[model samples]
Target: MSTSAPASLTGRTVLVANPSADLYGSDRMMLEAVRGLLKQNSRVIATCSRTGPLVDRLQELGVTVHITEVPVIRKSMLSPRGMLNLARIVMSTFPRMRRLIGAARADIVIANTLTLPFWTLAARSCRRPIIVYVHEAESSLSRAARTLLTAPLGLADGVVFNSETSRIACKAQALERRGKVRVVLNGVQGPATSRPPRDHIEGPARLLFVGRLSPRKGPDLIIDAAALLRSMGIAVTVDLVGDVFPGYEWYEDQLRARVRELHLEGVVRFRGFQSPVWEAIDGADMMIVPSRGDESFGNVVIESLLSARPVIVADHTGLREAASGFESAVRVAPDDPKAVADAVRRVLEDWGHFRAVAMVEAVVAQARLGTDRFHEGFGRAVEELDR
Candidate 1:
């Protein structure tokens, strides 16, 4: 992506408030947003709750970093105990966030996700333009919950949703009424050199799943599908390529237990979170993203397409948006092991045709979902908000 400074961002200080310092999907997108601002010659200041891989990456990019604790709301926080913890975080961090925004003298404040309403509240108090990049679509939540989660958008000067699915689910009608919403598709980095799908298959068709091993992400479904595929006499090896969040270890244990229960322990391999996942993508014959829960957008789906690898993704929400109009990406019913297995079987049966289509679709994905487009969209949003 070109770094030439957009007129609005030139020499302007942009404060970025991200909840986590991990290099996951939303975290990585936040990194891309920072990259775009830096390329445009804008001064960037980034604040995260703690230091992790993302902080290191931001430091490498020369962004001024502050380890500032901030309140990050989650679904679990709907309960009494969770509410108390959230209250404690807000009480402890809101003043710091307000002070940081003032000290930075940021022309505009960018909050990476809606989870951090405290940042928006702080930016509002500082009289800085605020942009909250919405990477979530919590339609599954109760109406009251959705209202509570999105109430912070009322304070934002601009609200950028990663997908239309997210935009609609967020119910940002107030923002919409004010013409403050933009749906910027998530930008993904693909392999540097796109290769055709392997021509000769000498062994079991290698299948890969690349996301958190959480029940929501449905890593266990891959195991179930593998067992189903085996029963159908289709040879395959399943690789689950990401780890769970801190509290989701139980889900991982359940996945392993299921593998043992099915007696396919040897057929499934647990590959912990691998960065620059192009290697795993290259090694696998095909990919499956069977998310059973809400996904704002499926970056992995786009990555698979860009690498010329066929993918099977859930047909709902942003996953559908990401893989739409691409025949190379097979959309299966969410949380269905049989559907996943059938999709895998279809690809293997017509491997040659799907492989060729994958190459063609890769070019289209590059044109439509490339990093440049991602950068351009955010740059435009900033310019509009500044005006």
Candidate 2:
């Protein structure tokens, strides 16, 4: 990796490819990166497989978004039918991608996630420098699946990792060891300094969980912990403030059923998909990130801290890195409702102390995770490719 400062991106035309059209953590970060690139006076053309809210959002940000036939390579792609589907999509989409790149005359191509290897193929044909921003930790992937995901990384001119945990995971795969790998931590626009503190301490301790209500995000575990807290005679209310993915509506249905089965209908409220998530975070006494699966990075964890609310996260993957250096934030074993319940109880028991610590820590964390710094680091990493 080069130690030189980032070269300017002025007048550069860059093409960005993202796997999903949803506004999840990775998608949101990609948008942020594009915004940063635009600020540098670079023209950006973004491509994705599907069309949804993210496409509209990008257009609003002055980005030209193209809905391409690029197949999203996932674990399913390992299956026989999936492999055939992938082959068909790649064969069909390759010519179109080549035309798009030629028309745009892109100076650099950025593939937002590891799942989108098609970008590498397209960029290579155009002879453009490529950057792969890896936001996933393959700890949960099967050996064959992980190989499929990491193999194409070697073809890139540069790779950007959202967290050190993700960087380490990629290194362990032994893929593209020679490429310039840089850890560019995800950034969030933190709340203002004069924001009001959470005041609901005397009555029910309002706990909040914000993320996609999926199995990996552990919305069910949050509900389970809420039940455990109630059974322990703790007065607590959990606000689950995010919706499930399109095909994963069944998981949301299961969560609602679990709330009823545990008789926690009153305690766990499903507040679907709150924008400016700080609004939800601000109303909580403390935040809980009970992720059952390995998280490459925990954006919500940082958001909670920036909101001056202490967070209790699962002690696994990049979440551990997110919660590091903050005494107010607590980490418990992943998938353990008992551990989550205990951590919640501990926060509530010393609510004032934890709240004070959070308020102080928020200032520090906000300075460290600002958008300017993130963009500067990201631009520098990309600029290194030009160097």
Candidate 3:
């Protein structure tokens, strides 16, 4: 009962302004969007703040890459000095962005995330149709802070919320009323075939936590949960996959120190960030997404489900939205190591039942949250802007 994707954009050009060049959840989503546009014969020009693997991939795909400094709004940039720096970056890059859009004769512009508010304004000044892709659901933020972040979406011709949670958190009801909003739940592709969950729960249970190693993502919580599980005579080895941001090295250090403090030296391993995380997910019996803060949607949770792996997620925001209705998925209280431990314990006790359920859910997830759906939804968003 779904409508077809819009017609081809043969003669149109798209300019995608993304905040980072890293291959994280949002960054990977951006890549898929670019691919979808190319399939429709739209010329794509991508702009990244810094150079990384994503930029390389774009060029390899024959998409023009424009390296520029993109002003990203973060919690650290809320102070006077931070605000001043943001202002300076805006002053320097705004005109250049507008000029790039005009020079490329871009018919449409897409700001990959709300972090790049400057891109929205630049596209507006260029008189190009712009779509803002909202990826974060900051229910934890103060109302004013949320407003400041979402204010630039006013200039966008269309707003694409990755999930309904994101739309509500951004207070985009007004935009929805104007028919400028589309909630396109992320479409993620897993391995070519679903990997079955481990047959036998022998030795220690393999637990995997994948995401940015930040306080909000709660890598520390995984360590605590592992410690608790071990204390209860449960043999478990925890693998913390993913890395920290440039300035958040301290968080990683704190995690290692906590592991040492808990004397979980050999039990806990830091795998850093792994691209194409299928092998890691396949190796683990279960995956955990313990975000202590707001998430627009749970790409990792979907990945785990698609891999036929049971997932233990913090029950709130998009995590709940993603993990709900699947028997293989377990929800625990956010920021509570005991809750995580208990959930893991329960799953271990009934491993056979959970694994069977995971195999079934993998097929359902593939049909519902697969890459094809994502590409079609992304195409529809652009087509709506064309109207």
Candidate 4:
């Protein structure tokens, strides 16, 4: 049976969060949720870091977006560097949040992350119910990160996880008192109609790897796999699609260094972060998800599938579940370049079979698991918090 809220929240007000707002997938999901909430007649006042790809998208959609800065302190905000960041979060965040919530008299607070101490603190003072949306896997995190993050878990009246893996991880990380955790998978919607075709894939077989340049994403392994493909005389081209996150230069350097060492420079290209990743994928023969740690749920994975792009993914937590139809996505060993190389060849060669199964999965996504379904489920989750 589906869960619905016992109480109504049609006239209630909510303070939705976008903690980092780094023009990434996280902010995009938050914006989509907020728009749905607005459609249901709930007043949503956004409190975020004040910049992202979603900002313009939201404005273009004609939503009322009020930005109250919620600084995202990646390192411990209580450390000397963290304390300075904490001070900034407090100084800029607290006052604006206090004024906004004070003026709006919000009934609910939907926090996008555990990082924003000021927003939830103000929500607590106002006696408003706070629903925490945990997009990350706290259990997969280093010990130090969990220590800094537990505060938000304790503060939340309820919790929403981005995927089932994230929900289990959240439960293991901390206890929820007022409400239980719910798994709300990220929504994947293709363009209203297809865009004009491009000829980028006319040469070699194009492959795409979307996300940051780091160990967790396992990009070096991907480069190694491409080099292996070159050795095997496969006409393949790999495009990596993200920049290094704050202070992760050493990890980025490692990937660049590997590309040089392996001589996969021409075969594998770092495309930086593309705004609409579909453009990159459309021109691709395949996609690779080389995650070292388990992904909570890769939006890119679903997005790739929706684009009818077959994938070769590491055997990680979320990918295992998402790659249900082995036809569309095949499993590879995490951090094993040779294994990845072997799997990619299989997926591309058996393209006709995988493409058929992948399209069926895409039908499920575009039909059953559309944004409206996300709205009905997540809006009900928020309404439950109101009760």
Candidate 5:
């Protein structure tokens, strides 16, 4: 790729490769980035391994969609049988992926996650400018996984990271110091106005957790915290509003069993995945993000702030960065149920003050993470490819 300005994106075609079709944090962020590209009058062709609501939603946005067998290499897929199956999928898909790139005649290729290094390989074959948008933090990856993931990053023309935390991690492990790296903080469509105020705070406090039900996300930690609060004579209701990932059904079963063991049937409720998650955030008095692993960026934390709800998040990796500027956010040690319960108690102890602070923080967060800023950063990253 030449480092001189070539052309504008007004008529340029872009191919976006996403690892999964499910609408989680990274998927939603990818959608937002695609929307930004469309606004620039660029033509887009998006690819995913499977069909889901995200694929349908992309089509609705006027982007051409390709459903391919782009198998993601995860830690779980490192076993002997798993590795064999992965190799078969990759071998079968590689040629087809290269053909798709050629057929699309894409001027730019954007691999939207670290898990899809194969997309980088295919894009290289097509001689298109490759930009890898990394959404995972380093602390989350094992040493072997880090090496495996970073190995192909040298092929990228430009790298987009969602946060400074992720940028530092990637540079330290995968990327060259001179690599073209851009830190584009993820943005959300801020709520029109602060959510309606709660009528009373003297009753049972409602807490919300809205992400995947996995060990990394620490949903079980929330349940344990709820039990602890109950034991201390505090009436609290915890609403878990996300489903377990595919192949993680056993984790959900474990969570349910733990809930039963703790006799917290009434205190904790599993309200599977909810769309327009703001509605769920609005219904709760506070939002909790008890992640036990590294998060590249916590979109849910900003969403809660935008909804004028106080947040209690695990103080780790990019999570600390996400909750940094908001006075309404309380940070607790990761995987510490007692710390979670204590933070919750502190927020509720002075509920009125915290509510007011949350409203103010919402205003600050909106200005920092507005759609215009996100679009500008995204546009600049793409435009850099032509230079």
Candidate 6:
């Protein structure tokens, strides 16, 4: 701890480093935190993202912006080509960040994910302690980056995980002997309170799967679940709202063929890469998170609850803790269509009781699910670290 901290963080700047502009869940959370902090009179300067929905939103919020490219070359560093490209990105990004950090002269530096620990290390020269926020657990990394994340993650003055599941998983990987971690649930801020109530049409429930359209998202299991329901003569339709992960386009195509082979022409809809998926949630009745990977937290869970709906999340090592007491949520075996179909039957058969439970949960969650709540939670964590 230092004897001096930046005063109040009002006019004092805070630099947030974003690794990529993928328009994913954690990216959105990072943008919201910046916007909320600004409302309290903080100035935010984001680095290495010139494009994405977040950069546009930050400009609209009146924050100072420095845009540059931190190209993520998704390949092995050991490759003859990969090393050359990575070295270029690192060299290019280093100068841009040094310029951004110098111009911003930030009160604090915020690492939006483990991807930007280099930014945290850069902040050391400026004497700004870093706040590390983890939204997803570790991945099987290139040999070098994994070693780098451990030490910086341990020394970060503040660490915030989006869910208890994520916090525990992150601790299990990198923080068990390190320090305290905070759980800051992702928030939803919008004007839905005055809207018309959802009408779950009696024909077939419209289910949505809203993560990457890869095998990791377990779309295969959801399709199998649909097949199981068809076997029982129950009606259900699903719309998948994600794009295939890079290099997995063939797998996505294979799943489509499986749907066709099963004669599920009208049962499954692949709605690809929907922007502002909150609208899709508005139209649908239930959301499913079938990820087989370690999911740190999910924003779709909050969106479904905001729409006064519920979810069926897969239970597995990287993701199971989400089934804890949300009444509206049920956890079944990951990648098991039998368990998935059973959970769906439970929801459809008891929709009324489930809605009542979710309605009350919605009222209680209003405060926690807003942008302000996340800002307050994160701000408190940083201030505590300063003291």
Query: Per-residue lDDT for 1-387 in model 3, tens only?
Result: 354435547768899988999999899999989887886778899999888989988998999999888778997676557777888879987888888898888989999998998888888887888899889898887776777778888888989889989988888766788888888889897797655787989999999999999999998988999999988999999999899999999999999999999999999999998988998998899999999999989999999999999999999999999987888889999999999999999999999999999999999999999888888778877788668
Q: What TM-score does structure 6 among the candidates reach?
A: 0.85
Which run of 10 residues does model 4 get worst, by summed lDDT? 193-202
Query: Counting only residues 3 or more apart in sequence or on different chains, how many pairs clash (N, Cα, C under 3 Å) in candidate 1?
Result: 1
Off by over 4 Å in 2: 1-8, 79-81, 172-179, 192-194
lDDT of each prediction vs. the true structure?
Answer: 0.89, 0.84, 0.88, 0.72, 0.86, 0.70
lDDT of 3: 0.88
All-Cα superposition RMSD per candidate: 1.6, 2.6, 1.7, 3.5, 3.2, 4.2
On TM-score, the stronger of 3 and 4 is 3
lDDT by residue (324-356, candidate 6, tens digit) is: 557887877776789888888898888877777
Per-model TM values vs. the true structure = 0.97, 0.94, 0.96, 0.87, 0.94, 0.85
The C-alpha stretches of model 4 lying farther than 4 A from their native spots are: 1-7, 75-92, 142-144, 172-179, 194-203, 249-253
Global local distance difference test of model 6: 0.70
Rank candidates, lDDT, best first: 1, 3, 5, 2, 4, 6
What's the lDDT for residue 264 in model 5?
89
Better of 3 and 6 by TM-score: 3
Q: Is candidate 2 or candidate 3 better by lDDT?
A: 3
Query: Compared with the true structure, what per-residue lDDT tens digits does model 5 show for residues 169-281?
Result: 77534444654778899998876655654845767899999999999899999999999999888999999999998899999999999999999888899999987787788
